[model samples]
Target: MIKRSILAAGLATALFVAPAFADDRPPTPEERAQIEAVLAAEGFTSWDEIEWDDDGHWEVDDAVGPDGRQYDLKLDASFAIIARDPD
Candidate 1:
């Protein structure tokens, strides 16, 4: 019974936590176009990954900026740069 309870608790936690990491996949074609245009306008020449986060934001990883340095960027739903972190 103790083992079963532990298993159930773990499963419950996973179920609840999963939504926080939802939409882990890449953007659709139209979404990609918009994202790419925004990146280009912001002087991001290249990016390694783009994740549509559960909070309706875009998480761009390994983005090469205008200064030719890698950065991690967070963009809001409107594709406006919200935060930038050096990678």
Candidate 2:
């Protein structure tokens, strides 16, 4: 009974954690280039805190704008700028 219980708990944990790890991979070069273009247009001189999400999109946690401000942004799978929010 204890062994069965342990197995059930393990499976539950795996199910909960699996999706959280799914988007941890880095963006491909094409995606990176696409993001670069959008950022450049927006005057983003530098960026950081990038991550890939389940929709096959990438989002920047924050970026350094040419005007000396920071902001957040997102790009769709095609590298199109989907959203932006300045900090």
Candidate 3:
């Protein structure tokens, strides 16, 4: 139905727009500390993209490892690595 299509489009647009706003705010100092811990542990130099998600987890994207591997990492509030997947 037209109503459903319109609603879907609006939802898609909101999802896309939301990240733009989220990116405007860099990681908090506490968050940066947590993220840094992960980088140090994994021997990564820096984070290409780091953001705090609604789930209270820091999602780190494109972390270049010591061996030159790109990694996407997730950390919980305590900064523990909950997930690490290759980019």
Report the number of the highest-lDDT candidate. Answer: 1
TM-score per candidate, chains pooled: 0.71, 0.65, 0.62
lDDT of 2 at 63: 89
- Choose 1 or 3, whichever is better by TM-score: 1
Worst 10 residues of 2 by lDDT: 23-32
Candidate 3 yields a Cα-based lDDT of: 0.81
What digit string (tens of lDDT, one per residue) describes model 3 on residues 1-87?
A: 999999999999999998777653458888787679768987988777788776668788888888888889888878888887998
Off by over 4 Å in 3: 1-25
Clashing pairs in 2: none
- lDDT by residue (tens digit), candidate 1, 1-41: 99999999999999999876675768888988898999999
Indicate the worst ten consecutive residues by lDDT in candidate 3: 18-27
lDDT (tens digit, per residue) of candidate 2 on 24-57: 6676788677778888887889998677877767
| lDDT at residue 10 of model 1 (Cα atoms) | 100
Q: Rate the local accuracy (lDDT) of all candidates.
A: 0.89, 0.81, 0.81
Misplaced by over 4 Å in model 2 are: 1-17
34 in model 3: Cα distance from truth in Å? Answer: 3.2
